[model samples]
Structure formats: C-alpha cells, structure tokens
Target: MLALAALPLGVRVTVLEPDEHAPARLCARHLHAPYTDPAALNELAACDAVTLEFENVPVEALAALQDRVPVRPGGALLARSKHRAHEKRALQGAGATTAPFEAIEADTDLPGALARVGGRGILKTSELGYDGKGQARVNSDAELRAAWENLGRVPCVLEGLVSFEREVSLAVARTPAGQVAFGPLVENVHRDGILRSSVFPAQVPDGTEARARELARAVADAWALEGLITLEFFQLPGGDLIVNEVAPRVHNSGHLTQDGGGVSQFEAQVRAVLNLPLSDWRPLHPTAMVNVVGVDGPDGSPLTPDWAAIDALDGTRVHLYHKAHRHGRKVGHVNLVAPDPGTLRARLASLEPLIP
Candidate 1:
C-alpha cells in the first residue's frame, strides 16, 4: 500500500503478484501470476525497471528478469538477504558488527552449536523465515532438538542472544548515481516477533543516532545499493549498535516517514530506481506508526474492528489493506503524528482498542 506514494511522482506502476487481492493491487495495475512463471517473467520484462516489496522473491525468477529488465538491488543482494547464513556473512563483510552464529545442518549438530553460543540461542531457518516464524528459542538440549524438528530439520543458524537496550532500524535510500538519503531512526516494539509499533526520533543516548546513520551509509555504499534499504540493529547497554538484519525494500518501521519525514520511504525508492533526484528528507513531526494485525473469525476470515472509532481520533490516519483478514496477518496500519513523543504515545494509547 505504501508503494502507492510513488504514483504522484508521475510514475506508472505495474504490480506482478500471484494473489489477486494483495493490498498493493488496490492502488496500482496488477498482473496476476506466480513470480516464477515464464509468462509472468515476459510480462515483467516490459516494465522500465522493477523493484520488490519484499526480499524473499525467488532468486531464479529474479535472475531470469535481470537479463530482460533492471531489477534494483539485483539478484546477488536478494539471494544474500533471503538466507540467514548468507546475510550474516554479508554484514560481516561490510564491516558491520553482528552476533556470533554458527550453521547447523542437522539435528545432531544442534547440541554442539548450542554449546558454542553459550547453551542458549535463537535457531532460525536458513531460508523463508519472517515475523518470528521459522525460528525457535532454545535453552536446553531437549528444546534444541524440538526446535530443529520444528524447523523441518533444515539448515539453520544459531545466534547467541545479546543483552541489548533496545531494537531500532534505519531506512536508507541510494540512487544509481550514488546520491543517498536516510529516514529518521525508529525505535520498534514487537510482540510475538511481529512489529507492533514504530516510534520516530528514537530515545537513545547521545551520539547513537549519528552512529546509526554512519552504519547505514556504510552498508548502502558496501552493497552499491539502489532504492530503499532498511537495517535493523540491536543497541547494546553500553550504547554500541550491532546489525540484526537487513531488508532490501521498504520496511514496516519506515511507515512513519509518510507523516513525520518530509518524504515517504516509498517515494524515496521511486526516486532512487528512476534515477531522479531525492528530496532533502526532514521530520515534520514526531510520529508513531502502529500495525493493525488481524484476528481470525470462526470461518477463518479476518474480523475487522470499528473504523469509526479509529477515524474519530485526532491526528490519526488509518490505512486498511484491501485484503481478507486471516489471523495474525498485517491487514493495515495507523499512522499518528503529534507535537512530541509524549503526545504521540498518548495518541497511540487512545487508538489501541481499535486495532485487532
């Protein structure tokens, strides 16, 4: 849905999606087909350039499109970000700090790997995991075996848990011509591994924000990145930051940019991919973006909340995805802007009951 912001920039969008009812299709022309279908590839090749909404796209499909049309951030970056092991290495190669991790290809290796991470760690699948899915927190040998079995005994990475003060993210945009822009650092709150809310102008020690900006710029330069890139970080108690994960597309944490920052992340991506000049992004106000997760009905459809209550709130803008709600799905979000962080938090609290 955020991608719709690019439309006003005078760019026509053609979304190639398998799901006819995907939210973004509501605002743009959509070609319904699987991403890996040859016919779909042919259709995508007609576009001037292509960018992805998410990073888990099939590498084979991207590789096929690369020869036919430009795919921003390219297949190499996509492949690297899709797998946990590869992403860790990429961050290290970029000279970014990351948690200690080891690969576990078999259930038997779980015990030894756990010991290496100090007997407690997060075991994540090497591929296809998001929002706390395909992950397990194991502290014992029995839990380790269960985690391995739960993940289908696939290749996995065991990461030592770090004692961090907070979780924050930086959204950076770069153009083919090497121009770069960054959205404000955002402090994220998560529940069950799914992002619950993003608070802009994150409350951190002095110099933390500058460090994050520097890190983000370095990562963007290292990847020769084009379009939007978000880097998640863990702020240690001592005020140091470590790379947590990288998302090579518009990020949920950046949704606040729509109202707080002078330009939205989506528009920045459009500018980057089109090789247009980026705006001087600045925060217009303190903002809070809260995700509206869905609840399953008895028939397994999404049960929506009272829109009137949400719309009645002052300084709040509600965006609902045109999708049938399924349990735990991100059906929409509410972006609230205020004069300061305290006002933003209060506004968020008032609207909490309206979100499923």
Candidate 2:
C-alpha cells in the first residue's frame, strides 16, 4: 500500500519476501526470496534507501543490509522494539509512562514474579508476539506455570493488568534531518486481541490529544527516527496515557489516513524516507476504518466476501489483500469517510454485516 502511494511521488518500490503469495506482491514489484538470502539482500542493498513495512524482519538481515544501504529507523530501534524488556526500558528512558512490568528469565522465580505483578497479569514472550499471539493471561500460580511452560519457558515480561478506559494510537513520521509529522490520534477497539476498528480524531479528554502527540514526538525524537513510527497507548479513566507498544512502521490504526488525510501514512512514510517535504497531518473528513476479518466456512476455508453488498455502499472504499485467509486473520479493511463523526458512525454500523 505504501508502495502504491510512493509511486505517484516518483519513488519506485521493490518488495522482498519469502512468500510468493504475499499480498503486497499485488501492489509492488516483488523479489521472491527469503529475507535472509544473500542474493535478495544484495538486490535490496542496491536500492536508493530501504525501509521495512513490518518490524519482524530479522536484525541480522538488517545489519547486513545496513552496511550497503541505509535502513531507516536503524537496527538499534529494531533491536530494542523487538524485545519486551528493551522496549520497556527504552520507553522509560524516554520518560514515557508504561504499564508496570517485570522481566522473567529462566532462573527468575515465576511465582514470585507473578505475585509481584498482582498474581493476575499477562505473561508475554520477550520477542515475536503480535495480534494476541505469544501471550498468556493468568490469574493463578498453576495457570502461570502452564502459561510459562506453554511458551517454552523462554524469556518473558509479566505486565500487571491495567484498568484502561480506552485504547488509542498515534502515528508519527520523522526524517533524518529532524523533520516531523503527526497523524491524528485514533481511537481503536480490539476483539480477540485483533484490531476491529480505528476511528480518527479520537474523542479523548480535553488534554489527552495534546499529551499523546507530545509523547509520540518524544519517542520519535528519542530514536532519531528516519521513517514512520506508531505508539499504541492505553488511556486510563483518569485521563492519563500510558504507552502500550511501539510499531516502527506504518500501523494498522492509521489506515484511515489513506482516505481522510490527504497525505496518507504511506505517503508520509515515503516522504520521510526520501527526504521529501511532509504535509500537515490534517483529516479532510471524519473517517472510520474497519478491519475485514476472515470467517471460516463449513470446509474450514475462508468464506468469499459479499462483494455485491460491499460495492453498493457510498463513500466506502474496500482494500483486499491478495492472500489466503484463516480465522481472525486481517484480510483487508474498509474505510468510511463522512462529513462528521455521527454520519461516519452510522455508515460504519450499516457496513457491519459485511465486515467478516
């Protein structure tokens, strides 16, 4: 998607992926090779500059590429964000608030760690966890032990449960020259640990928006980010915002910017990476973005979408990923833009039946 946006700006994008059927292949020129493949890395290194769409790209691969081509957000940011303990320490070092957390290594006393986190907490793998995977919520010692064992008893972080009022995300872009741009704070709702919807210009408390923007800028600056970064935050009932997680690339929560913000997150990313000027992050209209999850059919395959119903909606744009789907997998998204929030909400409600 970002590649498509970059094309009009005279930026050519070449994607490198191991899966030939990867959805991004539909939109950009693709190299069908493993990310760690030396041949593929050489091809990528030949590019003017390189930026990653997903954060899970191996640090070793990136380090090899960095010697030849510039990797935005850099290896240090990737190394820190990929590990829960490092992420927490980075956020704390930046003076950003985060949930109470304790690291659990192999030799750590599991019961004592659980007790320290109030006995009811989420134990997450230190690395490679997303979309609700690699985490276990436990309320008892037995469950904690089971969770730890289930995770192969690897390194983990135990986070105390938080009573947050709502979840929101802020997407910010920065260039190597210190230029910065911030997208609107988006209020998001998650179902089964997957994001269901993201509404822009979140209806936050009076000072919350300002605070989120400040914190996002601080994070971007802290990392000396050269591309886009997203910060997921938990807004507590008392109007305090705590950093939940960080994604060092274009984020799902900022998908609405594709339609509502003249300069979509993709374009902003391209601009930042190419050293082009960025536009102000202002929405042209109120928008609601709903993720289209895959539904299982009788034979256990993903059911075909209701294209007839989806095509009939006005002011709604549908983006479908050209990939096979599984239950709860993000196949695509629908963007509904309107003159105001009320109308956007109504449109979103009417389109609910077509979501899955």
Candidate 3:
C-alpha cells in the first residue's frame, strides 16, 4: 500500500502480485521478503507497467517483468540480498565495514566456519528470512548442531554478534540519472528480534549521524540503484558505526517519514523510479514511530483502534496496513511528532490505549 501511495499521479502503476485478487496485494505480502516471485510472468501479463513492493520477489518473477517493463534495481541486486553471505560480501567489496561472518553450505566445513567467526555467532538462512524467522543464535556446538537441524540443515551464514550500543538506520533513494537524497537517521528498537519502535534523528552525536548518512549514500552509489535503499547500522560503544545489512526497498524504520520528514521514503522511492528530481530532505518534526503488533489483541476478530482519541493529539498520525490480524503481525503504526525526542516519546505513550 505504501508503494502504491508513493506513485507519481501521472504515472500508471501495474502492481505485479501473486494474489489474483485486488484487496490482497501480494507484492507486500511475503513473510521472508524475497525480492523475486516465481509468479511474475502471470502478473506482468495483466498490466502495461510493472513495479514491486517488497525486495523478496523471486528472480524468475523479476525476469518475467523485465521482459515486459523495466524493473528498477534489477534482478542482480535482488539476488544478492537473498543470500546473507552475498549481501555481506557485496558490502565489503564496496569498502563498507561489516561484522565478521562465514557462509554455511551443504558441504561447507564447520571447522572452517568456526575459524572465521569463532564459537558464538548468529546463523541466518541464505534466502527467505526476516523478523527473527529462519535464523538462530548459536553460542555452543550443541546449539549450532540443533539450529542446523531445526532449519533443515539448509545453507546459511554465520555472523559474529557484536556488543553494540544501539541500532540505527538510514533510508536513501537514487534516481536513474544518478541523483540521490537521504532521510534522517532513525533509531530502531527490537523485541525478540522484531522491530517494535523507531525514532527520527536517532539520539546520536552529530558526527555519528554524518557518518551514517555518508555510508548510506555510498551504498546507493555502489549499486547505481534507482529506488529506495535502507542501510542498517550498529553504533558501537566507542561511537563508531558499522553497516549491519541493507534492504533494497521501503523499510519499516522509515515509516515515520510519512508525516515527520519533508519527503517520505515512499515518495522518494517513487520519484527515483519515475526519474523525477529529488525532494528536499528535511524534518517536519521530531518524531517517534511505534509499531502495533497483534500480540496482545482480541482473538479471531479485527482489533478496532481508538481513532478519536488518537486524532486529538497535535501532530499525531496513524497508518493501518490492511492486513488480517495474526500473532506478531504488523497491522498498523502511529507516528507522534513534537519539538524534541522526549516530548515525542511522551506523546507516543499517550496513544497506546488508542492503538488497539
């Protein structure tokens, strides 16, 4: 829905979705977030233009779309993101700092992996993994063996976990003509490895923010990418930032931009793909975005949010994704903006009752 909302008014968008229905846009429905979808051939035939919402579409699907209309970022970048090892390798080649890691394949030696990353590391699947799924944290030999068994012994990557102070991210977009624009740095909070909240102007030092933005811009240039790209970073205790990962699509951390930033991530992504000039990247207000997960809501029924109360606050905004309710499902989000981070935090807390 966000991807659709960002489209230029004059540009006609034919959404290539596996869902044969209108209400259910499969483009934004993948759990693992694969950039390619095998059903692309059929979806592309239904329209004159084509675009994608998620990065997890199957490569074969994008190939089909390429035969019809031009696909931004192309299949190569999408394929690179599916495999954790490849994504890390690409970032390294771009001269970006990342955590030490090793690839785990069917015949790959476990002792060789141990030598590269040490005993404690996180095992992530090669393809189709997100929000803590298809991943496991292994600190011992028994855990590693169990994780491999639990994951069906599929190919994976082992990334050594670091003792970082906090998680931060930057969202940037690049035009087909090579122009680029960036959104404000956002601080992310995760619960059980799932994103719970995000705040703009991430309470980091000015120098740190500058470095984050620089890294993001460099990534966009590295890909020669012409769409939204989100780069996750880890702020170390010593005030240095290291790139964690990249997502070649609209990111959860940038959801606050809809009402807080001068140019929303959605709009930026749209303009880039449409070959339009980039908009000014300014902050409308200091904002904090809270994710509303369906964990503690009513069962077997839609949870109706208290909109009247939410609409009363100044600069308070809400966005509800039209998705069916399920455990841990992201149904909607609330963005609260104020003069400072503290005030924004307080305002966000006041809207909790209105969330469900």
Candidate 4:
C-alpha cells in the first residue's frame, strides 16, 4: 500500500485488504497493516482494477470482485502460489530447477511421506505461511512431529534444505501486450531465514543475472502470469541455480526499485494490470535496503525513530508502514544510495546500530 502510493506519475491506486474487524482469519502469519476496512468493499468493488500486494488473499474474495473489477494475476496464480508443494511442482514442470520436496496431509501416510524427502528439511504449511512463519526445520521424526504440533498439525509439505552459496532473486513484470522487463538480480541477506536486507547489482558471475532473468520469465510464462512475479533462487555451490520459491506479487527484495529503477515495482505492477507498456527494469543507483522492525525503547514503549537522520542520508528513501508497532513486526524500511560500494556499506553500517 505504501509503495503504490509512491508512483512517479498521477495514477489511481485502490487496495482491498481483508477487514481489520473480519474474523481475523490466520491468513499469512505476518501482515504489517491494511489500507482499508470491510465497509469499503463496495468502494473497492467499484474500482477500475485491483492488484494484490501478497499471495495469501482468499480466492473467494477475489472471485467475488471478479464480476465487478479486473483482478490481475487472477485465480490461477493465486491457487498455485498458495500451496508450497504445488508451486515447486509447477517450477519443475516448467523446466526450472527446484529443490526436492514432498506433500503430506496430516491424515495421510505422514511417515512414508516424510521419509520420501529424507534427511534434515524445511517444513511449511501448504497454505497461509510467509516470512519465516508456518515453517520449521526438521532433522528427524521427532522434529517433524514437533513441527506438526507447533504448526497445529496442519496439512504441510516438506522440502530438503538446499546447501547453496547464496540467495538471489529477480523481479519481472509482463504487460497486457505480452511485453516483459526484468529488474536486475538482487543479492539477499537473510537473518535466521527472514530477509534482513537486499543489495542491487548482485555480485555474481557475468552470466548469472541474464540466466536469473530468463528463468524468472520462464516461470512467469509457465504459470500464464500476467502481472508482477518474484522468483527467488539459490546459487548452488557448483554455480548452478535452483528455484527456491515464487511470490506472485510485489516482493520485499524489490524495495530498491523505489529510488534505483526506471520504474518502481508498484508502478510496474500497476502498468502490468492496466496492460500498459512495461518499463525497463534497469538499476538507477547502487543501493541497499534495511527493514525497520519495531523495537522497544529502554522504557518499554515503542521506540520513536529519528526520522531526521534516516532521511538525511544522501540518496536515501524511507518507508514506514502505518502498522501498530510490535516487537519484530516490519514497521517500515530505510534505503540508502552511494556512488560506490564503499559509501553504500558505510551508510548501512552507520544505520544498523541506531535502528533498534
């Protein structure tokens, strides 16, 4: 919602978030904030079009809106994206490399299914999981059983963990005219499996960026996706790329696009949904982003950020999601730009200690 509000030109943007007062369906375990409430459904339903910020939205709700508005990346992508096992299967079927995985229903052949994907693995709920939640690492049946217990013993899929050199992602958008453009590969740094920062101009081999973009386009076309799609991959120790996950909406990794791309992710999605020409996804700066999670002050109140220092950095842009401050919640982000790597690193280092 914040990103869409930053479009470079005047464009109408309407976001349909689940009602804050709705039954609180345990949609994704984490959502920073919503742009509106349920009463606005009529208003949203009357909009020219709609785009999703994440993939966990209920298909039923989207279907309800379909008769009244154009929903980009409609039901097909949503159905495939909601299930982990199905998403990986789609990637492999599309001739994209992916980690080995198995699907398991809480009531069916649980033991044998777990055995199929042998050794230490990551277990994720088939539905309603994101940002390190609804997932657990299992090294044995005990761990698997415990994960089931922790995850409320829901239907889930288990995937063998990829021992990769690093993680990188490509963001691509397809226009109504079938034109496609890709942003450069983003080098991601994860803290305990949750994304902590993203660096543009991924420090990889000469051909890596090209290959990543090609693969991302392939995956998007495979799903017949028509809007923004984010494909995350792991560079294996042998220099091979394996698809780790696919997000059918705007992504955290694309945040740098705001200050460093010809078209920001938000505007690109808008264009794709509106069937406008896709812009070049080239880098506009050597930039990096750090998530501003809610931190407690010494007195136990929500820490009041020094927005002055954050906005003062050269080529820096900050976004603060209007969410109630809570521990570990992603309340906002800080982006910094520099002429070279040295300045970028120094800027990040300078902001790290002060964030908390």
Candidate 5:
C-alpha cells in the first residue's frame, strides 16, 4: 500500500521481503531472501531512505544499514518494540500509562507474578505475539504455569486485565525534521483477538482526545520517531487511556483513513519518510472500515466473496490484499463513508454478510 501511494509522487521503491509472493512485489523491486541475509541487507542499504513497515525485522539488519542510508524509526525503537516488557517500559518512559504487568523470567516467578497482577492476568510471550497467538488468559496460578509451559517457558509478561469500556487507537506520522500529523482517535472493535472494524470520530468523553494527542506526541518525541507510530489504548469508563500495545508502523486500525477523503496513512508515511510536506489530519466525512477475514474452503482455497451482494451495496470501496488465503488471515478490507455516523453504521452493518 505504501508503494501504491508513493507511485504518484514519482518515488521509486525497492522492497526487501523474504516472501517471493509478497504483495509489494507488484509495485516495487522485490528482493526475495531472508531478512538476515547479508546480501539482501546490503542491497537495501543503497536506497535513499528506508522505513520499516512491519515489526519483527531483525534490529541487527536495520543497524547494519544505518551507516549507508537513513533508517526511520530505527533499530533502538525496533528493539524496544520486539519485546513486550521493553515495550511497556518505552510506553511508561514516554509518560503514557499502561496496564499493570509482571515479567515472568522463570517457572518459580509464575506464582508470585500472577499474584501481583491480582491473581488473574493474560500471559504473553515477550516476543513475537499477535492476533491472540503466544498469549493465554489465565484465571488461576496453575493455569498461569500451564500457559507459560505452553509457550515453551520463554520470557513473558503477565498483564492484569482492565475494566475498560472501549478500545481506541491513535496514529501519528513524524518527519525527521519534527513535523507531526496525527490521525484522529479511531474507535476500534476486536473479536477473537483480531481487529474487526474501525470508526472515525471516536466519541469519547470531553478532554480524552487532548490527552491521547499528548501521549502520541510525547512518544514520537521520545523515540525520535521518523515515520509512523500507532498507540492502541484501553479507554476506561471515565475516558482515561491505558496503553494496550504499540506498533511502530502502519496498522490495521488506521486502514479507514484510506477512504477518509484526506491524507491516507500510507501517503502520510511516504511524505514523512521522504521529508515532504504533510497536510493537516482532519477528514471531510464520517468513515468506517471492516476487515475481510479469510475462511478457506474444503480444498483450502478462500471462500469466494459474494460479489452479487457486494455490488448491491452502495458507497463502499473494497481493497483486497492479493495474497494466498489461509484460515483466519486478513485478505482485504472494505471502507464506507457517509455524511453522518448513523448512516455509516447502517451501511457498514450491511457489509457483514458479504464478508463471511
């Protein structure tokens, strides 16, 4: 998507992806090899400026390229983001509040750690966990131990659950020159631990928006953020925000901005990385987005989308990822815009059937 957005600017892209079938291949030069492959890293170093669009890229590989070209939101931030414990520290250091958590370094630490988090918490691997994987919700000490054992006894963080009324996300893009443009507080919905939908103009209590804005700016300043950072939060009943997780890249929650009649996150990222001017972050209309989760058929092909039903709908735009489908994978998303929130909700509710 970044490549797609960059095309109009006459910017050439070179993608470093291990997957031969990576979607970016269609739009950019595809270097197909392991991320740690020294040869691939060397080739990537020749680009004018590099930006990481995903987490889990080895920070060492990025560090190697820093001497040759600019790496926005570079190695230090990636190192902090790759581990959950370090991520929480980064959040707190940026003066943002996060959920209570205890680090689990050994089996003996489980009982004490669980008790510290109010005797019940979600145990997540310190590294490489997403979409409900590498984490378990445990209600007992034995369950906590079992969960840790199930994760291969790796270093983990047990975070106590909070009683929050809603989940919201804030995304900000910053340039190396220090200009910042913030996407609005996006109201998000998740089911089975995956993002389902996002709505703009998050209806929060008065003053919540200002605090979220402050946190986004502080984190960007603290990290010396060069591209984009998305901060997902748990919005409490009274509108206080608690950090749920942070992603130092374009995120699922911000997909709605593509059709928001304003500067899309993808384009903002391109402009930020290239040191181009950024527009203000306000949109012209109410917008919403829904993810198209893949549900494969008997022979392992994705279930065909209901085009007839989709065509029957109006005022919605569909974007497909064009990757091989696997059960529970995100294959595409649909966006809808309306003059008001109520109309957008009704139109989005009608899209649910077409996805399944």
Candidate 6:
C-alpha cells in the first residue's frame, strides 16, 4: 500500500524483506535479503528516506543507515517501543493514563508482580509480542508460574486488566518540523487479541475524541516523532480514555483511510518522512474494515472467499495482500462504506460469515 501511495509522488521504494514471496515484491524493488544484511543496509542507505512499518525492526540496523538517509520516527522511538515495559513508562512520563502494570524480569518477581496487578492479569513478553502471541492469561500463582515457564521466562510485563466499555484508536502523523495531522478516532473490535474490525468516527463524545488526539499528539511531541504513531485506547463507561498500547507507525486500525477517498495513512507516512506538507485527514464516507484473516473456517476447513460473492455485496471493496493464507494470518482486508451507521452495521453483520 505504501508503494502504491508513493508511486504518484514519484517516490521509488526498495523493499528489504527476508520473505522472497512477500507481497511487496510485486510493487517495490525487492531486495530478498535479511533485514540486517550489511549489503541490504547499504542499499537502503541510498534511498531518500527510510521508514519502518513494523515495530520489531532491529534498532542497530536503523542506526547503520542514519548517517546516509532519514529514518522516520527515528531509532529512539523504536527502541522504546520494542520493550513493553519501556513503552508503558514513556506513556506515563508523557502524562498519559495507561493500564496499571508491573515489569517482571525474573522468577522471584512473578509473585510480587501478580500481587501488584490485583492477583490476575495478562503476562506479556517485554519484547516481540503482537497479534495475541507471546502472552498468557493467569489468575493464580500456579497459572502465573506455568505461563511464565510456557513463555520461556523472558522479560515480561504483567498488566492489570481494567473495565472499559470499548476499544478505539487514533493515528497521529508528525513531521521533522513538529507539524502534526490527526486521523479520526475509530472504534475497534478484537478477537483473540488480533484486530477483527474497525469503524470510523468512533461514536465517541467530541471531547473524548479530542482527548484521544491530544494524548496521541502529546506522546508524539514528547518522543520527537517523525512519521505516523497510533495510540490504542480503552474508553471507560465514565468517558475516560486510558492508553492500551502505542504503535509508532501506520496501524491496521487506520487501514480504512486507504479507501476513504482522501489522504491515506500511507501517504501521510510518506509526507511526514520526506518533510512534505501534510494533507487533510478527513474521510468522505463512513467506513468499516474487516480483516481477511487466513482462509480457514472454525472447523479447520479451507474456505477461500469467493470474490464474486463479495462483489455481489454493496459498499464493499477488497484489498488482497497476495500472500499464502495460514491459520490466523492477515492476508488482506475488506472496506465497507455506507450512507449512515445503520446501514453500515447491517452490512457488517451480513458480511461476517464471508470472512474466514
């Protein structure tokens, strides 16, 4: 998607991905090599600017290219985000309210950590955890110990679960000069810790939405960010919003902008990284996005989606990643737009069975 967005701007992209069959290979210049390969890093250094789409990028790799090209969002932010403990601390440091949590780095810390977080919480790896991976739920000492052992006993953060009405996310784009663009707050639904769908405009109070943007911008400003940063929030019944996690790049929740008939998040990333003028972040329609996760059904049967059937539905557009579908893999997404919320909800319900 980034490659498609950059093409009109005449910005060529060279992708360094270890997966030879990566869908990006179809559009961008494919450098089929490991991310840290010295040769690949040198090749990337020749580009006008470098931006990361995922958080697990090796910070040292970005450091290697710093002297030769611009790395948007910078290596500093990446380092902080790579570790969950550091991320939570940074959020609180910026005066954002996040879930109550404690960091655990050893066996003895488990008991105290559990007690600190109300004796029950999620144990997540401090690093390399996403899409419901590298974490476990625990309610007692035995469960915590077993989960920790199951997780390989790595550096982890125990987050105390809190009650909230719904989940929402806000995307913020920042330039090197400190200018910012904020995307509308979008309500999100997650199944098994992976994003299932998202709806635009959030159905949130104007002030609550404004507060979300304020928190996102504050973190971006504090981090001296350059590029897109998305902050996920849990909206409480009392209308308070607490930070859940932060992604220092364009996020899955903001994918609706791709078909929203305005400046998409991909373009925003390009503009922010290149120090170009940003565009308006408003969308033309009320949009909802449902991820096309793998092609498997609940009974473990292959159920590849019929494009014709999908096309038969109104207000729907398909975006395929052109990758092999494995269980729980996000191969692509479908965007649905409606004249109003009532129609959108009905469309989503009808389209649910079509997704696998």
Task: Name the top TM-score candidate.
Answer: 6
Predicted candidate 4 versus true structure: per-residue lDDT over 1-356, tens digit per residue: 43343344456554454455321123221222343334455566776666777687777767666668777787778878888888888898888998788786765545755667767788889999877888999888778878878888788888887788889988888875688888768889887556888888677767887788778888878877788888899987656799998888878988887777466776777778778877767567788888887778788888866788877767778877667777767888887777887778788787666566
lDDT of 5: 0.87
Query: How many pairs of residues in model 5 come into backbone collision?
Result: 0
Estimate the TM-score for candidate 2. Answer: 0.96
- Please give the TM-score that candidate 6 achieves against the real structure: 0.97
Of 4 and 6, the candidate ahead on lDDT is 6
Give the per-residue Cα lDDT of candidate 5 at 282. 46
RMSD of each: 1.8, 1.4, 3.8, 4.6, 1.5, 1.3
Question: Which candidate should be chosen as best, given lDDT against the real structure?
Answer: 6
Candidate 2: tens digits of C-alpha lDDT, residues 133-185:
99999888788888989999899998989999999998888887888888888
Per-residue alpha-carbon lDDT of candidate 1 for residues 13-72, written as tens digits (9 for 90 to 100): 888788877666777887888889898788889988889888777888899997788888
Give one digit per residue, the lDDT tens place, for model 6 in 292-324: 887576787867876788788999999999988
- Candidates in descending TM-score order: 6, 5, 2, 1, 4, 3
Which candidate do you rate higher for lDDT, 5 or 6?
6
Predictions in order: lDDT: 0.85, 0.86, 0.75, 0.75, 0.87, 0.88
Off by over 4 Å in 5: 297-301
Q: What C-alpha lDDT, on a 0 to 100 scale, does residue 277 get in candidate 5?
A: 94
Give stretches of model 1 more than 4 Å off.
280-282, 297-303
TM-score of each: 0.95, 0.96, 0.87, 0.88, 0.96, 0.97
How many Å off is the CA of 308 in candidate 6?
2.4
**Who is ahead in TM-score, 3 or 6?**
6
Q: Which ten residues in a row are the worst by lDDT in model 4? A: 22-31
